[model samples]
Target chain A: MKRGVFKRSLDSLESIFLFTSEFVRENHVDPSLLPAIDLIVEELFTNMVEHSSASTADVPMEMSTVDGGVEVTLTDEDADPFDITKVPEVDVERAVEELDPGGLGLHLVRKFADSVEYHYQFSNRQARIVFRKTAGSGGDDV
Target chain B: MFDLERREAGEVVLKGRFDAAQREKAQALFDEIHESVTLDCSELDYISSAGLGVLLKTQKRLLAEGGRLKLIGVNSHLRDVFKYSGFDRIFEIEPG
Candidate 1:
């Protein structure tokens, strides 16, 4: 299995796509997993930029092949020690008129990825999120 | 970056990435509305939660005002995104 790592500057939201797509292309990730991987990467990177207190940190991203699929690890050094997997699920059952859009990102991320893990290094104030997506996997819950 | 192209009436073509950075620009499209609107997303490559949020807001507004939101030309990748997010049931998505 090949391991690829890179640091992305959050200066522009464009880097999120550029970095992720470039990584996917370089690593020859499965085409079937592109959407899930793309969504997972986008949500995590955007959340870091919008919510994290860090103004200028090169977010670390790691990608590797696993037994059933691919694993993505995103490290935010300046972000608060929070577990994304613990975020409350969106009320998808709510009527379209009553639906709330604010909390769907993490929920969708969790649903799209097969397994999600969180790690925080208190000493360095870093939070690392590991998302695994099996090939041909479908979303678990809305 | 995202591109908005107007086709006929009540239809807007979407291209490129629709994400947080493009939300404001995308939301501005909702300022003027008629009885209905359709977004042609054949060229759209990606959408994030922020982009989806804009659609939700617009859809609610349109429905409240007796208008409808129809999505056309959704590629399979985006369709999966909508389906996994459970948006397939919320909106009328037409395949390309």
Candidate 2:
């Protein structure tokens, strides 16, 4: 498993990408999976930075190889419980004029990852989001 | 590393990743486009929802002004993103 603690800002996205690249290379993850992994990580991290009122400056992330896939865990410390899984579904079928950009990031996260799970620790005010993407398993059919 | 450039012929070319960090730069470029235009995404490797948001905003604005944004040279992976996000219906896309 590889771990990284990133600053709570959009600028940290570059660092996050670098960390993800290193993890992918080190773990021998499939190169085809890079885009999906990158997309999922970016959406989740962006959510934490924009929505989670976390007081901590560091957002910890962990990535590891799983059977025919990769797993990632992100924790937002000192933040309120925002169950990302509970976010209302975005109506992608909505007309262009009616479509709202809000929630689109989370929507994509759900569509690209094979599985998404959320856990919150009340005592510590921490939100942990874990998602997995398996080889040959894009969430297109989900 | 994302680059958005407007060529002298008036087509906008996009290359590299377009994520949250590149939103402001993309928006600045899109803001100046008021008429119908083609966005050449042949070199665009990846795009997140933040990037999608910029495109949606620009498309909407253009539509309001009786114009549209046509996208060409989109790879299969990006086409999937558009299909999953329902953005395929919002813009005219020609696969690369």
Candidate 3:
């Protein structure tokens, strides 16, 4: 089951969310769980574009619904084997001035998703998340 | 991503949504400023955490060089985000 692949860009985010949402909403997907999907996607996908494409070069991104959940896998040739789960958490409550908004992207992904896991094979790193259906949940809130 | 532009009065105005895609370009624009930079955040309708990250980094860079990141005309919504993130303690945000 192939989902959809998008070029790394800001304009593509809405389409990605809408496209995934449409697919999820039409079937056995719950409504309360949509925002989580969108948020995690934005957080992870945004990092891919920024750190990979923004600094390096054009990268490949593919997304699909697998195992009864939405999966977005990004492939970046020569990308560092960075794992989002390994990054340290940002102390959002700290008093600071002009601090780089550090640690928010991956932080949001982990906070909103039910479960997030990472895999690396052949130099490609993938962050996979699963959202469980909890009575009234759909990945479309945000 | 955001485009940092230097105005005539020493203002570094950014015009565009600072998302994943525009990040590199924003970095390039940020490199051009040598002093205190006033970022135009009015047209900025939405900012992901990634954008926020870049803004934070850029602010740090400018501040370390005896410069600063001043935001002008930030909408109430984004202002709330800045406030919520406690970024208000970092950057000098002025109402436009």
lDDT of 3 by residue, A2-121 (tens): 356666666687677676578677655654455455556677767776666534444344545555465555554455567677788767766555244666777656555555666555
Provide the TM-score for each candidate, comma-separated. Answer: 0.87, 0.96, 0.56
Put down candidate 2 lDDT per residue, A25-140, tens digits, no spaces.
Answer: 88888767888899999999988888875475689999999997799999999898889899899999988889988998888888889999999999988889999998777643
Q: Rate the local accuracy (lDDT) of all candidates.
A: 0.76, 0.89, 0.61
* Ordered list by TM-score, greatest first: 2, 1, 3
Write the number of the candidate with greater TM-score, choosing between 1 and 2: 2
**Least lDDT summed over 10 consecutive residues: which range in candidate 1 chain A?**
A1-10
What TM-score does chain B get in every candidate? Answer: 0.90, 0.95, 0.84
lDDT of 1 at A108: 79
TM-score of 2: 0.96
Q: DockQ values for all predictions?
A: 0.51, 0.64, 0.23
Best by TM-score: 2
Question: Best-fitting candidate, measured by lDDT?
Answer: 2
lDDT of candidate 3 at residue B57, scale 0 to 100: 74
- Which regions of candidate 2 fall more than 4 Å away from where they truly are? A139-142
